[model samples]
Target chain A: MSESQQHHQSPGSPPASGLGLALFWVYVLLYIGFMGLVLVRPDLLSLRPFFGVNLAIVYGMGLIAAAFVLAVAYMVLRSGR
Target chain B: MLHETSIAAVTIFATFVLGVIGLSFFLGRKGQSASGYYAAHGQIHWFVNGIAFAGDYLSAASFLGICGMIAFSGYDGFLYSIGFLAGWVVALFVIAEPIKALGKFTFADALDSRFNSRGIKLSVAISTLVVSVFYLIPQMVGAGSLIKPLLGLPHEAGVILVGVTVTLIVVTAGMVSTTWVQFIKGSLLVFFCGVLTVLILGRGLAVNAGREGSENLTPQIRTVRPDGTVLVDGQPQSRDHDLRPVGTIIRLPERFAGQESTGPLGPLAYLATLEDSTIVTWATKKHADSEGVHTTYTPVERPGTELLKPGGFFKGLASGNLPDRLDFVSLMLALFCGTASLPHILIRYYTVKDAAAARKSTVVGIAVIGVFYVLTLYLGLGAMTSGALDPTDTNMAAPLLAKTFNETLFAIISAIAFTTVLGTVSGLIMAGSGAVAHDLVENVCGVRMTDHEKIRCGKLAAVGLGMVAMVLGILFRNFNVSFLVGWAFNIAASANLPALVMLLFWPRTTRQGIVAAVTVGMLASLTWILLSADTFEKVYGLSRDLALTPFSQPALITIPLGFLTLVVVSLLTPAPASLRR
Candidate 1:
């Protein structure tokens, strides 16, 4: 705990970051759900078109963007706490 | 003259190589101690280390193989980039902080932190070596494939060239040099690729009429004789080589029938216009007759609509074959779970100062990596219609796409591709050397060495691993690097991820349990891959039905088995008091 504010005291701080852990599960769930949809209903996944691209492309882009967003969100929450 | 070996390109590539090697020598003086050698004294800036993470992670497979795959097979290739980028999520949120907190030098250091068991150290050291070697093969193969066009050297020569060069970098300064090299390489790679993408958008899509509207994208054949000569389309390729460049839109939709191309379209408009058009994609079919091995490159015309779909590369998904579907699912599972599990990636945590720095660096890595992957979609599509693809070697897609712009752009891209391989191979060698010197010799074998001796031992290990990588790369030159990387991911996920996750989260994890899980996971995945249908058909030249494994990928079954073995063994044996909290 003393190592949180101090940069050079310890080798590394003990890991108790709940935000990163929580987001880990969140991202995992999202990925599983995405893959499941792709396997179960390929047609439905491809049916919805957005911005001249199909639902699959849209979803894939959304997933990548979500990863970046979630990572930033975790960073903010960690620093804020 | 477009695809011929260019003197200007070779000069540029030589300059880049000399600059990288010189940078390594300059940084070599800082790594005298073991900590500096292995972890860069934990002084690297979080942002620089973060970009370095991207450099180490991208490898040749991500830059060259994925782009080539997309240019040839369409959307299926982008799925790889997606799966790869998503894996960083696991690294950021789960592994980054805890791994930094627990380990000092190697991944084995983290797992063995609670219990100083020699068995655990020995098992983990061996596991790291196996994973690192598997990962090194593709990077070496990618270097081999890249050098052929860039310098007109044979593939085997390229493998040895990179192998020796990377070994020198690791041996000179260890992690200090490796980190900075990766940082410079990563930034250059992403920047140049972004530049290439902008150029792609500027030139726009074209129906390649080959200076005449009546031209067609025809199939070209290549025969490799026992004497090591290459005959292209039933004739000996000239001194500069014979296989002409390929990849183009042979036909447009009815609305654009009068025009040779839809010039200067926007990014979104490019995709929309491409969707309505018909493009020529090549497929290679091989036959071994009395003369020798003959491979025929066949051109297939497909609508842009179907090309944009996901079923081309992974045939099982579209064919509705249950076993094939299982293989696809398993490969994806591995990629999703593999990033944090990789030894080179794990060692990166130690390069930064603390857990917070590690976290920040991971966040930075994910952002850079994510953006690059999105750009791959544009680059791949741009290359698919670039009109400079070499139908025989899909790996040449990105460089060839740059060639469409100018000779200078092509030279820069190829040199950067080679740098991509160098940066990744150095990191992997560093990991392998650490495993050998720190874990195997010192901790496991109970050999005491001075600080100076440890560095010497690590350097020896790097040289040995580099030689092994060179041999394997030459042997497996025919396989696509992305596909080889998938096997590496599957093995890493199965062998390492289970033990890592359990040790961090589960209080009941025993040292014995970890040793068992790693050994079982590593051995099982390797065995499964050896007996897989794909390996039988491709490597052994046997019928697919004769393969022992039901599917090619081992992650679907092996990953769970790793967890199961760990949990069951931990329960059966009581946790040692030394390990208990």
Candidate 2:
């Protein structure tokens, strides 16, 4: 097999990038914050901050939205390199 | 609840199943080579592979289980949706590119790439098999749940049908057919669910929506006799005799009081309206009697505000007890970490051409999955107030909710759901077969084989796994499908995640450490689950108080134990020369 084709088939891992790791920890903190609120102060989640929906719903939906946004960010930032 | 066999449902379901199998046969010719059979020759387009990821990941658990959970319990079910989607972030940001770059076919290929150790191959392969089988249980149970309502067949028949069909799909074309099947299933599921959600928003909220003449809102009683005969409300159960359909709004918001309906609310308005309504949810109690085992479904009126919070089904959030609270945290932790650790999910990275495709596909998967999960909140709440829930089977909430709208929608949704089972079960069987054929036989046992021989071995493995899945599906029929899936996430997260993450980020990871982590993680979580209170009450049919473990979900404890084992073992052992800086 040609070297390029072989590399495609069995490519080695490149060094870990800073941007991806940073994006990952950013999500980790968001997820942990949601879990922490649910455990410690669930009453706060019950409060309807906006849209007449509870903070729990808002935060949960936000986590899903944040994941997609951060993922797109990583894809765009990494492709630039 | 009783279901009459519907000709339209049966026909749509048969067409779906046959169409999937025919597609497999058409794709079978291309999967003759081992590489093609295992990874679709790594040539699938990024967009197609992305949708295919949704097909593979959104199992019966995500569709039927999560929807039913939300319908029956309220906000606690959506908690699963958030946790499940969050795991994809880990997949995309951390595991996606690296896994694609390192592995050719199985997750073991990625783990063993740097070490090339038989120990790593053997342990990781075993972990893959355990996780796959655990995950397969819920899909098969979901199949049984769908078939009972759609075709009016028994649960075991549904399990067998799915097992046989999924085995055929895997043995016929392997990943090539599996990918296409998933693409079709994923696209149909998201599109139809989108349609269903719009219908829900358009219909809006109603006071006692389908309970027009049902003034007798009494709790219904069902009994199963030792002689295998069944009775509902002291009458023999039949097509004409069954528990009354339940779940509806008892009262609307104070602003809309005395109003029959709040016409066509928007998404936010729907939640805001439901938050103020008084919803009637069911609670069940069982007791053994001289006649048989009688179960009663009693109606409980809960405020929309309470149901919209975190405690309805979890009970821990409501009780605020330490053990219960810890169990909830542990389950959420497992759901967060488990996505990247699943064997079927990991192997999908190998089906793409390169690391970049893997990364792109994961992003695509998140978008599709995220949209579906958002819709789940609506679909579930819609069902909760649709006045069409079967008290005996929460898993049938979504399909039955479709029935409340129209029989044709019910037929189409149930058919798509059956295909949902087919798509996910095939992917799981593919992962299991790869573990058995490539990882265990070829690498661990050192059995050399030609390409044709390898393909044959994988087909055999697929058949074996299908049979195992069928048996487990039958044995665990009574448990909620989503609850069973939680056990799978716990095992996969505890057993696979620690080793995988450390191997990529930590330089001191040794070959021995990988083996130790996988083995210890797998065993610890499995042992914890077997001793848990949920298992005691559900599996062994014993009292929960007699259980050995303090809490049910084990990921909170076992996941950290996995990382600790890896770190401690790697420090004790010498690092490979290449890993040294």
Question: Each candidate's chain A: what TM-score?
Answer: 0.76, 0.81
Q: B203-266, model 2: which lDDT tens digit per residue?
A: 8888888356642568889999999898999999887887888899988999987778898899
lDDT of 1 by residue, B1-581 (tens): 12468998999999999999999999999999999999999999999999999999988889888999999899888889889988998888888888887888999998888788998899899989999999999998899888888888889988999999999999999999999999989899999999998888777767772345543557778888888777887888785657756668877777777888676777777777778888887778888887778988787888988888778899877888899889989999999999989999999999988878998999999888888888888888888887777776667789888887889999999999999999999999999999999999999988899989999999999999999999999988977889999999999999999999998778788888999999899999999999998899878989999999999999999999999999999999988674554
DockQ of 1: 0.46
Number of backbone collisions per candidate? 1, 0
Which residue pairs does candidate 1 place in steric collision?
B246-B389
CA displacement after TM-score superposition, residue B196 of candidate 1 (Å): 0.5
Q: Say which candidate scores most in DockQ.
A: 2
Which lDDT values do the candidates have, in the order given? 0.87, 0.91
